[model samples]
Structure formats: C-alpha cells, structure tokens
Target: MVKEVNSQELSQILSNDKGRVVVDFYSTECPPCEALAPLLIELESLYSNDFSVYKINRQDNRELALELNVRSSPTLLFFDKSHEAGTRLSGTITVQQLIGAVVDAFQVEARTLIVPDAHENIWDVLILGAGPAGLAAAVYTARAGKKTLVLKGKAKSHLELAHLVENYPGLPPLSGKELLQNMETQAQGFGATIEMGDALDLTFGHDMKLVTTRTNVYKAKTIILAMGKGQHQQTIENEERLIGLGVSYCATCDGAFYRGKKVVVYGNDEEAMDDALMLKQLDCDVSFVSYCKSTQCSETLHESAKKKGIVYYPDARVTSLSGQATLESITIETEAGTKTLEAEAVFIIQSVPSKSLLRKTGINVESKDCIAIDKELRTNLPGIFAAGDITCGGLQVAVAVGEGVSSALSALKYLRQNS
Candidate 1:
C-alpha cells in the first residue's frame, strides 16, 4: 500500500494535510532498507486512514537526501502540515519504533486510532548473528529438529572482506565469501532459515523473548547472542584508524601473525590475561598492562605469567598507540613514570560498555560490551545463551563455531527440560 514517489511527487504529497506523512528514504543493496519494506507496507495496510507511507529511492534523489541531512539508509522522516514533524529515525526500525513515531506525531488521542498488535510467533531459537558463530549454531539447532532462525546483520561479516582464508582446517586456501557461502548452504540444507536484517529492538522482560526486526516481532522460546563485538564506550585514539596495523581485539585471531614480535596486552581482566598467555604461547614477547592501580587479575594468572617469563606492568595504563600506517609502539602511564614499549601489536581487551542494549535488558554482563555466560554458554537469563565475539571469547572463527555449537546444545537442552 506504500507509494513509491520521486522527490517532485513527495513535495506535493507533503503540501497537503493527510494526517501525518511517513516517508522512507532508502537506498538499494541496503539490507536494512530491504528489511523495512514489508513493515512499511503492513503499516500502510493497517493505518491508511491515519497516515500515508511513501518510499523514495535516495540514489535517485541524492539532492533531496542531502537537503534532509539523511546520511543513513532506511531513514524515516515524519511530516505534518507540509513541515517536518517529530524526530527522524534511521538504521534498523521496528514496528514499535515506527508506530510510536506516528502516535507521537499525530497524538493518537487527538483522534480515534486503531492499533495493531505487533508481536508474531513462533521461532524456537533465534540467533542474532549471521557470522561464523551464528551459522554454526544454526547447524546444530536445525539438525536437532528445532526451528532455528539466524539473522544476518546489516554489517557484513569480516569474512567477506577477507581475500583469502587458509586457517580453517580441511579447506584449501579460499576466499572468505566462499567459506561463508558454504557454511550458509550447509546450515540451510538442514532446514535452518537464515534471514537478512538487523534487530530493531528487543523485549526480554517476559517469559517469551521478543525480538523486533525490520519484518516482524519475533517470539522465540530461546535466544543466542552471537552478535560481533559490542560497541565500545568511546573510540580509542588512533585505534579505528589502525585496526589492522598494530591494534587488535582478539589475540587468537591475529596472534599467530604477530608471533616472534613484541605485543602488549592492555587489560585488567581474566580475558586480557588469557590473551597475554595465548600470545606468550605463540612466542610473542608479551607485555601485560593493567589500567587499574593494582590488579583484580588472579594471582594464579599473575604467577603463571611470571613462570612463563612474560613481563607485566600491573599499574600501567595505555596512553596512546602510535604508528602512521601500521602500529609501531605503545605509550603507557605507570606509577614509576610514563614509558613507551616497543610493540608490533597491542591487544586491548576491555569490557563491553555498560550502555549496551543487553545491559538495558538486564542481561548479566561481566564487563562492558561482552555477555557473561557459563562454560555451557548459558546466560543468567533462563532461555538465553551467548557465544562468539559477543562473549569476548577468543574471537577466532573456530572459537565462535565451538561456542555456537555449545549455545545450540544449551538451547536444545533448555527446550527439552521445560517441555
């Protein structure tokens, strides 16, 4: 029921008062945009008398997009009385977010309105990530005869960026795209359904976990956290600019490449200690730096490092990572004095930021961004489990796969126990 409009048509549509106008500014080859189309159609179908839905291809209307300051795909702009009204929404959008905008724009009490229940069932297990971890989980869940759905996020997997991947066992050197394709096909062969979209909002305060995507409000019996690394509280200096240079998050993923080189592990937690040890095992000259004055790092881990002859600066904090094109050295502040450590790589392992959505949902988190889970991959929530980079677990494809399988098994067990 949504109308496709050019900028000229949109201008006229906006001039007349037809309640409130919901304009979707979208671009092609945009996953989130594709995910949003159905929802817009459904909204139009339900509330044609309340508001009108219109779509504009941003590519065909670059001038209009720029004029509106529309920088991202799937941006929803609400207009009333030939003027912009209410806040603008971009990226992944849910029916809740969309409908709320209408209610706010029109103030439903201003007139009689019919609202539709947005929640839809009934997926048994909903995996949030479509990377190696998510795909691996789907294989297990589907093979167990459980109805599993994996969401391929709007962010492309790093695998797709990888030109060549040789570490995966039994596989000859192949492109990451091919490897990912193979994994998807295998999981689908087992009857697992893979969806492409980003989760707009999540509701977990009740027994049935509700995940809202661009298309539907999903009701799932169990959920898995396989989304890639959580967003950091703040960007680190020169960090994003030097991602593949000398800065890294997952040691195991990039450790082997740095063997025999100097590397510093900057963290105060067990995960950080684990990275330091893993690097040491790979023959990297490892330096452990703690942001805290002393250390909550286990004495056992400290002693193990000492036994391995790995150096430590428990009271030091990284001040800067310097290198033009590649990482060259690390600067730190210590109780003794400011010092610089020569290093090829710096593995900065920090907790997931507290502002993460998972925290908003009251999921137990060990630190900033990463989810907390037991060995069995069970989250504090009864029907939720976590795996892969989301858990800050090694961050390697193999590690994600292993955790995905573990999470799937845990989900299956939870379902059976309850049934």
Candidate 2:
C-alpha cells in the first residue's frame, strides 16, 4: 500500500530516503485531482523501483496541505529529499507534460539539467523584474533547468512609452507594447512564473537573498536586479502646471489623440529618436529640439524622419514654457537666438539613468549613475546581480536582455556552489 503521510511524516520520509519519490497533494472532490490520479499511478508503475509515489488527500491531510502551502488541489511534486522537490505542478497538468517533467527529474544526472518547480525553494537562480532584462534571464534560467521567477508589476513599462519602436532586433516597426508583450509571452512559454508586483525591498542572507514585496517575501540563492531606468522629467518652470493637459512624457500613451497636430520632442539622445519615430509614424508633425549641439541618433531614425517629413532643429534649449491654463508653446534659446515654437504637446526624453534603488543598496555606481558590475553582471555583493540600463552600459533592449541572460547563468553557477 502507498504511504499516507502527514507533513511531518512526509518530511521524515524524504530525509530518510535515498531513492527518488513523487508526492501528490490532492482531493477526491477536485475534478483536476481526480484527473491526475491515474497518471500518478502510471508513473509509479513505469519507473518501478527507481521511483516511489505517495498521495496526501487535502480533506484528510489538511495540516500537510497547509504546511506545504498547497492552495489548490492536484499539486504534484517530485521529491529528491526533505529539503528539496525537483518538479512541482499546481492546478491541472496535462498527462504528457507530467510525464515529461517526471522523465526530466529522474534523468537529471544523464541530462545535466536541474529545473526547479514553482513551489521549490532551492532554485539555482531567481531574477527580479519582467522587463527585457528579467524576461531574458527567465528564458536562460528555465532553458538551463534552473528555477526562475520574474517579478512583473501590473503597471506598464518604460518601453511602452513609444508608439512604435523601429530599432529593436528581428522585427521592424513594431509597437512597443506588442514587442514587450511578445517577450513576456515567450518567457511564460518557457515555464517561468511571472508574478505581478513590485519588489519593495531586498536583503541578503548566508546562502540566499530575500525579496520582500507588499504581499510576501521570497528567498533566492542568487538574484538579478534587472529593473530598468525610471522615467525622467524636465525641470522647466511652469511645466508641472500643465501635466496631462498638453505637457506629456509618454508619446505612445498620449500620442494618438494628438494626430496630425504639432508636437515637440525635448530630448537630445537616442531616446528622443525613439520617441520622435513613434510620433512621426502617428502622422503627427513632430519636431526634434535638442539641448545638445549634435544628436547621437540611429541611422534608421534619421532616415525615417526624413521620409516621414519630420522637422529637426539642433542646439535648441527650452528656457521656459508659456501658456495660461493649458500648454500653448515652448520658448527656446536656439543658435539663431530665442524662438517660440508653437506646439500642442511636448515629450521629454532625458537619457539619465535611474539608480536610486541601487544607490540605496550601497552598490557601487559609475559617474553616469548606472550600477557598476563585472563582465558577469555581479555587483559588489556576492549574491546580488544587476542588469539592463541600471548597469554599466547597453541601454538597448536587446543588449539588456543579453546581459540579463548571462547574469542569470552566472548566478545559477554561484547558487550551485553554495546550495
């Protein structure tokens, strides 16, 4: 007969056993649990002596279920030991997927893979943020068979500020949201659990780091902080008065309504090019006014602007804004002297890196306010890693994604040594 064990007994069973085991926290009333029952028995018969299977009914084993934090029925976990479970599947899982998971778990040594489940605490690595960096980390970590979770907030990302981003690799002229969503969807497809919420604070322990949010705290052996730069605002005198009315920072979010109208881009870097490219695509008469003498713009951007008939003005600095109630026009000091440019909306795209959170953690930073990290994306702290625009260079989405992936792999190696 199969063992009917409580949480304490199950804990003891794992601690004492050297052989592999499968435990299912289930309920008879749950249709999904009932559906998975036959599959569990099949796995037991298929693996034979190499594998052991156990079942804990949720109704009769309430304490065990509670202790393991099993909220839903039909949760299957492959047990390697008391302290570790290799594969965990919550909710209804397909028979083929369950078989694949079991095969992967028992064949760990042969396959050279050690993928962590959603419920497992002993992961090789955990990445923060679900943006380009975090999502990239998730893909690499999961494919490497390491446990990975991406903390994605419900709010939109900074990348979604552009109506159409033309410079990202592979796809050409894709909407920012569409591109970000594609990355997020691909990460989820690879078994990474994308949790929605912000990481409020972080603390480091002996072998693991703790991520505290408004709801719960998660422990990871290694962490990658891939949260990108924060939004930058212009400090023009009276600009704050007309916020949401005409003065805007996000062109993609508020650009469509101002179609065929005159708008001004108050930036001098690649971000300005990204913003102006989107506005120009919206059929809006977009003009680029730079605080810097020459713009460091993309080749496609320069060509696209010319093709779309967008105006470009170099060495134009905004001294102040003018309007009674709403935004009317901006007064600028150009090389030809002071000039007032009539516009309905102004988009601010400052290239300043936001590293206030990292600064609070005492991570060493560069003169440009980006966090300093080695080639492997390791910060001064042993278990902490940084990626994306928050780190040394590479402000592009693709580069940030590559950085996050490499950092996660390095973090996994670090975790394996300590764990």
Candidate 3:
C-alpha cells in the first residue's frame, strides 16, 4: 500500500527501512502527482515484500522537499536503507521509463514493456499534420515501401473545415471533409500508419529525429512539417514568462501539478473541454473559458460539465495572465464584461505552437514566417522538409499535394543516401 508521510515520518521510515523504498515528492495542485499516484500504488502491490512506497506532500513539507532537491512535482527517489539510490525521475514520467527505474532500484520481477513495440521502432518517414500535404507525403513514402507514420493534432485541419472544394483536376465538387478522408484512405492503403496526437516536442539529430506526443515517443529518419500555420500562438500576456512557473500548454503533463487547486482552462476546442474534465477528476477547482459560445460546443460536453457542476464562461477570452513566483490569477474578457479569476494555473489547450516547435529544431524561416525550403521542399536542416502553407507556397490543395510529393521524394533520397 502507498502511505502518505510527513517530513518526520518519512525520515523515520527511511532510516528504519531494511529493504528498498521509493519516495514520491508530490504537490497538492499537481496533475503529474495525481497521475503518478495510481502507478506508484500498483508498483507497491507488485513488490509488496521487497519494497515500500511513501508519498509526501511537498507543499506541506517544504524544507524536506528543498533538502531532497525536489524542484518539481512527481519526483521519484529510490532509497536503499537510508541512502538515496538509483536514478531519480521527474516530469512526464512514462511507464516504460518507470519500469526501467524499478528494475534499476529493486531488481524485482521480470517486467515486460507495457506499451506497444511499434512505438520503440524507428520509422523511415514521420509526417506532422493530417492535412492534404502531410497525407500526400505519406502516400508517396509509404508507396515507396518506407515505414511511415503521420500524427494529427487535436484541432481539425484547415482542409477538414472547408465546406466544398472544386478546383482540383479529377474529382467532382466534394466537401473538404470528403477530400481529406479520401487522402487519408489512400495513405493508409499504401501502408502508412496514422495516429491522433499533437507533436509536443521535436529533437533533431544527424541520423534520426525524436518526436514526442502526448502518449508516445517516435524516432524517424526524416521529418515532414506540413502542419501549416498554427491557430494558437501563445498570445496571452505573461504567458512565456510563467511557462514553468504556472502557465502550461499540456493538461495531462502539468495538470497534476495543480491538483486540488484552482485553475482555468482556456480554448474553444473539444480538447479544452476534455482537459477541464480531467482537472475536475484531479479534484481541481476548474473553470472553463471558451472563446466561442456555449452553443458552439457539443451538447455532450455541455451536459457533462453541467453534471459535474463545472462552471463555464463562454464567449470569453483571457486577455492576460498575472503572477510573480508562480501563477496567481488570469484576466478574462467575456461577453458580459471583464473579470478576474483567481487561478493557480491556466491551461491553454490548442494545437502545439508550430513556430516554437520549429525554432527548437533550428529550421530556417524567412521574414514572412514561412519555412525556407528549397525547390525540392527540403529545409535548411538535413533530413527535415516543409510543405503546404507552412512553406508559404500556394494555399490550394493541388499546390500543397505537389509540394508534398516533392518533399517526400527528397526525404526518400535522404533516407536512401543515409542508409
């Protein structure tokens, strides 16, 4: 069983424990801490006789947390007798990583990888976005017998929202939705795998690239950036200054940090609603502020919120975020008027900011903020390419598809040469 310990109690247990022990330094308003709670409990059950699990609330015991150098919530420190042992883990802890840590700490039980094996395999081509350009690139690469994976974001693609598209050469006047479906079908038919998750982070390298999503990590030989311009650009005031201090883009990643504390969810998408609900489960005082109307969201989401008694401030936008050492509150401008919300954290749930992601990969961009791509649609960096509106090319579907093909061929060439 998992035991909640104070500073003195934790010290006593650690000093007396003959076997291995794992200490989880958690905070009250921390979603990561909440996420780790059940996992640690399960681990306790798995090694009932070999190890012990103890969780101490860092907020309630600040000196102990500081002494342990626990700068973040959900920090797992393994102990052998009274001395700290093994590697410590903090932030966005994965099951596979946790399992490895357990083996290193306790060497207890023969463990199997909990997630699918495919997530660990390297891909020949990895495409970002599920729009026409990305799908077209996937179709080409997958048809060329290259292992391909495409990740789509929570926000519907700009192409997916079109009412009708008729300018293309072949097909009749079809809905944008239908055209996109056909493209996805073609890519899948060519053996390309498509999954739904925003590209949260990108790590570029000489031979391989690492892309982290909400759930999985993927490695690829070549990366295709076809997400186009993002709808969210981190516009709120003081948002950047307080990134780690309080304002977070990912709910599941940072929600545990705000567990049982007042926080606000800002966005009009279904993802925002889903995150707000998750916060409620963490016992957070969650208030949702949708940029659109109450009627704009699904009835199911509305009903769910009503049932949960979660307050909603529709047709609202946060003008600014305010805090010093940590986030304190947010200023919202609703249809009614301006109001201030006392919040420990604010979750901006939207598509991952493309510009920010691009900057991290060191991709060159012109003054137009469009990617600098060669005629072959290859970016300045090797093994990286851009397509569609992101390249500041023609916005039409045909132009996007043509660029997509060009980029795919370039990526295939890069892979062949590298291999």
TM values, all candidates:
0.46, 0.43, 0.70
Question: Which whole-number lDDT from 0 to 100 does residue 14 have in model 1?
Answer: 81
Which tens-of-lDDT digit does each residue in 127-180 have in candidate 3? 998899999999999999999999988767778888999898888999999999
Q: Which ranges in model 3 have alpha carbons more than 4 Å from their true place?
A: 1-119, 170-174, 292-299, 306-309, 324-326
Error of 1 at 166 (Å): 23
lDDT tens digits, residues 54-125, model 2?
887665676666677664455777866544455677544544456667777776322222222225364456
Give the runs in model 1 whose Cα sits over 4 Å from its true position. 109-140, 147-223, 227-366, 372-385, 392-419
- Reference-based lDDT, each prediction: 0.75, 0.67, 0.81
Sort the predicted structures by lDDT, highest score first: 3, 1, 2
User: After superposition, which runs of candidate 2 have C-alpha atoms over 4 Å from their true positions?
Assistant: 1-123, 231-356
In terms of lDDT, the best-performing candidate is 3
What's the distance in Å from true for residue 70, model 1?
1.8
A best-first ranking of the candidates according to their TM-score comes to 3, 1, 2
The candidate scoring highest on TM-score is: 3
